[model samples]
Target chain A: MLATVDQHDDTSPEIGGIAVDRLRSIIERVERLEEERKALSGDIKDIFAEAKSAGFDVRTIKQILKLRRLEPSAIEEQETLLDIYRRALGM
Target chain B: MLATVDQHDDTSPEIGGIAVDRLRSIIERVERLEEERKALSGDIKDIFAEAKSAGFDVRTIKQILKLRRLEPSAIEEQETLLDIYRRALGM
Candidate 1:
């Protein structure tokens, strides 16, 4: 017997024998996290504005942040590709 | 004369001697990338839905994604702390 197919709750679907309340709770938790994520993104934009006002190159800072998130080997591979592209472009 | 202070373009502010057009271009590029990121997040959510329909544990998959993004030492440290917490709770 598939619990989800029984469809007792219209709003929340159950999986296995999991209750509708549990599924709704999971959805609510994900929704709350998403709200927090959006707020954090706005905070990040404010920090970028602060950095720009301080004469920092926000674009370069963003690039550095992306590179730092990657492993060293991945960064090396990206640099190699970048160098190749630069040479091909006669830069 | 600070290029940003002169405020030639009301929409886009310049930094140093950089043109307002160039600054606006950078901002537009970031905005475009953010749009793509949102689309990718939607795609990821769809994948999670598929996984759940197939009876897979979405939470464990998310945890695996997070652990894979971290360095080995960071994961180990996290696991160590998790174990300590579990033991404290008599798990």
Candidate 2:
């Protein structure tokens, strides 16, 4: 009776034929990660603020961080594409 | 003894004078997040593969996902800036 009284969950709600508990676990983990990511992003924004105070372009720093994650060949390919696009646009 | 060998941990490795255990916890948590992120990324790539098989442009989908996270005003500002840039370049 106590267990029944305390349990309003799982009447098991399934989503798209997936087991609800498993789907809920995945959703919860993703939500948790999103929260942590938001916090870490605030930390990153603070670092960008520090960089701005030191007279650095935070946007370029952001691009640099993005580029650092790419392979050299990938970066070269992107740059070449950008060059072509710029030339085509008369920029 | 088993206890002695098992207990050899803090012999505490410090970095930059920060408390070693606290630093280790932060590093370990970040490392855990990185690992989970990598795994979740693979899941996202699988979804992208599914999208590609369904004849969707994944890069555009990625951009849409990015845009969805932005405020409407921010999106408008970006569009305006892009239009200005395009006009400036004779695009």
Candidate 3:
């Protein structure tokens, strides 16, 4: 019930000396980014639909995109680690 | 020299049944999203600066945000896994 804005009263609780305005601004900004992220994700899904129409494997394409983001050395290192872990687990 | 847009000539190579136009569109969209993500991250950093100015631990705040994103059960499982791994490594 403390939704009162622009008040200098003790009723307005500021936890740990955090300014309510600043906290609200940060939250609003993050929410805006989250909205944009959701839109971008939808766009990505649309692209996946297009790719599927062109006979592309969506899962493989996603994997390729993720792998392309990684450095070649990093990919190699990860593969080596996976091998080691599997060996250790007797898999 | 292979940036010849709008030509159906054999000089425009299509790799592995992938449409060059579609591929370019996908890459452009991903790049745009990447740029937006970078900008959003900078905005988040600005919020961290504001928080720090208000006597908050930026690192701890970052950790709290990350932990907040995870489901409670998932976090508990991750903590259990970490403990198990640490014990296995004798750390």
Candidate 4:
């Protein structure tokens, strides 16, 4: 009954007996976080650009960034699999 | 030369003539953003928990979240492929 609308309240909207306001609040929180994510992505890109300007290889630096996110053992295992795959493909 | 260390400075360390300080700065920036990303993920999970407590299906909500992150056409195409695969598998 917490988020249930008053039946007599004509201005209020309800879906499945739940108030529209509650649903909207839940959706709006996700929307706000999505905007923040976009901004953060742009900020990260700006840092990459700075690294490039400083004579760094942005592509390699990005790869390094991703590799650093993983455990060393995981990277080594992935490398082993990748090498096997390349060899299987006769590369 | 801005981030290049003085060759005469015994305290300075460099890799391929690039200062470790510069490399550390780049790594640290990514580390900071990763922390922020983890915090944001927790916030999103909290919202999902709120929705779940309010009688919403969190698994379906998570699917909706991922679907929202993609283009409508992409989703439709993926759904088509998924349906074909499922049918082929007699599911």
Q: Which prediction has the highest DockQ against the true structure?
A: 4
Model 3, A27-64: lDDT tens digits are 56665666676677777778777767766667766776
lDDT tens readout by residue for model 1, B1-91: 2224345565655556655554554455555555655764675577568657755578865675566568999999989999999999999
lDDT for A19 (candidate 1) = 51
Report chain B TM per candidate: 0.57, 0.61, 0.52, 0.59
lDDT of each: 0.63, 0.57, 0.68, 0.79
**Clashing pairs for predicted structure model 1, backbone only:** none
DockQ of 3: 0.09
Candidate 4, superposed: residue stretches over 4 Å from native: A1-16, A84-91, B1-12, B56-91
Winner by lDDT between candidate 4 and candidate 2: 4
Q: Write the per-residue lDDT of candidate 3 for residues B1-91, one digit (tens) a residue.
A: 1223344656546765555766666656765776676676677677767766765566765576678689999999999999999999999
Candidate order by decreasing lDDT:
4, 3, 1, 2
Kindly list the per-residue Cα lDDT of model 2 for residues B11-52, writing each as its tens digit. 755444434453334334444545565665666556566555
Q: Global CA lDDT of candidate 2, please?
A: 0.57
Once fitted onto the true fold, the runs of candidate 3 whose alpha carbons sit more than 4 angstroms away are A1-18, A73-91, B1-12, B45-49, B52-91
Q: Pick the candidate with the highest lDDT.
A: 4
| lDDT of each residue in A1-91, candidate 4, tens digit only | 2457678887778878876777778877987886787777788888878877777777877788889889999999999999999999999
Docking class of 2: incorrect
How do the residues A1-91 of candidate 2 rate in per-residue lDDT, one tens digit apiece?
Answer: 0001113456655454434453344444444555566665565556556555544455755565567668999999999999999999999
Error of 1 at B30 (Å): 16
> How many steric overlaps are in each model, in order?
0, 0, 0, 0
Off by over 4 Å in 1: A1-19, B1-91
Q: After superposition, how far is residue A48 of candidate 1 from its true place, in Å?
A: 1.0
Structural similarity to truth (TM-score) of each candidate: 0.40, 0.38, 0.49, 0.60
